[model samples]
Target: MAEVRPAFDEAARTHPPLREASSARQDAHPRQIRDDDLAYGLERVLDGLAARLEA
Candidate 1:
């Protein structure tokens, strides 16, 4: 129960911070995200995830 409590509390605290960060980003100018940039970002994210999973 003690171990679980910390995990739950951490998640609760983290959620608000993430939401705030996202809100801040949303408040900024909406730039045109090019398809090439989207593809590059997705590839980088997937590659990082794959490397972590393989480790």
Candidate 2:
């Protein structure tokens, strides 16, 4: 793998701090998670399993 320092410095013009990186990721994927999404996903998985068993 390529050394990361050179590309990182070129991108940030200095060593980017942890706060900047964390904030970028958090902004891209907000933390306000919903239980409804999880439940819906689980329901789909269980439904698939039930269908397979019936087959």
Candidate 3:
């Protein structure tokens, strides 16, 4: 859970729609950051799980 929450917070912070809704309500931004976060977070989570399995 600790590992996951940072990932989720990072994704939430970078999500284009949420950014727009909160501050830049008149603009649209790319979702690349969020996508990258998703990939990175998934990789980290899977790696952690795999390490636990190996232990």
User: Which prediction has the highest TM-score against the true structure?
Assistant: 3
lDDT of 2 by residue, 1-55 (tens): 1365456546765545844764454433233324545777999999999999999
**Candidates sorted on lDDT, descending:** 3, 1, 2
Q: How high is the CA lDDT of each candidate model?
A: 0.64, 0.60, 0.65
Better of 1 and 3 by lDDT: 3
Q: Assess candidate 3 and give its TM-score to the true structure.
A: 0.46
Q: Write model 3 residue lDDT over 1-55, tens digit each, in one string.
A: 4455456557768687764554432222347546766899999999999999999
> Which residue pairs of candidate 2 clash?
none
Model 3, 43: alpha-carbon shift in Å?
0.5
How badly does each model clash, as a count of residue pairs? 0, 0, 0
What tens-digit string does per-residue lDDT give for candidate 1 at 1-55? 4455456556657598765654454434435334545888999999999999999
After superposition on all CA atoms, what RMSD does each candidate show versus the true structure? 12.3, 10.8, 12.4
Instruction: For candidate 3, give the lDDT of residue 14.
Output: 66
Alpha-carbon error at 20 in model 3, in Å? 21
Q: Which candidate comes out best when scored by lDDT?
A: 3
- On the 0 to 100 scale, the lDDT of residue 55 in model 1 is 100
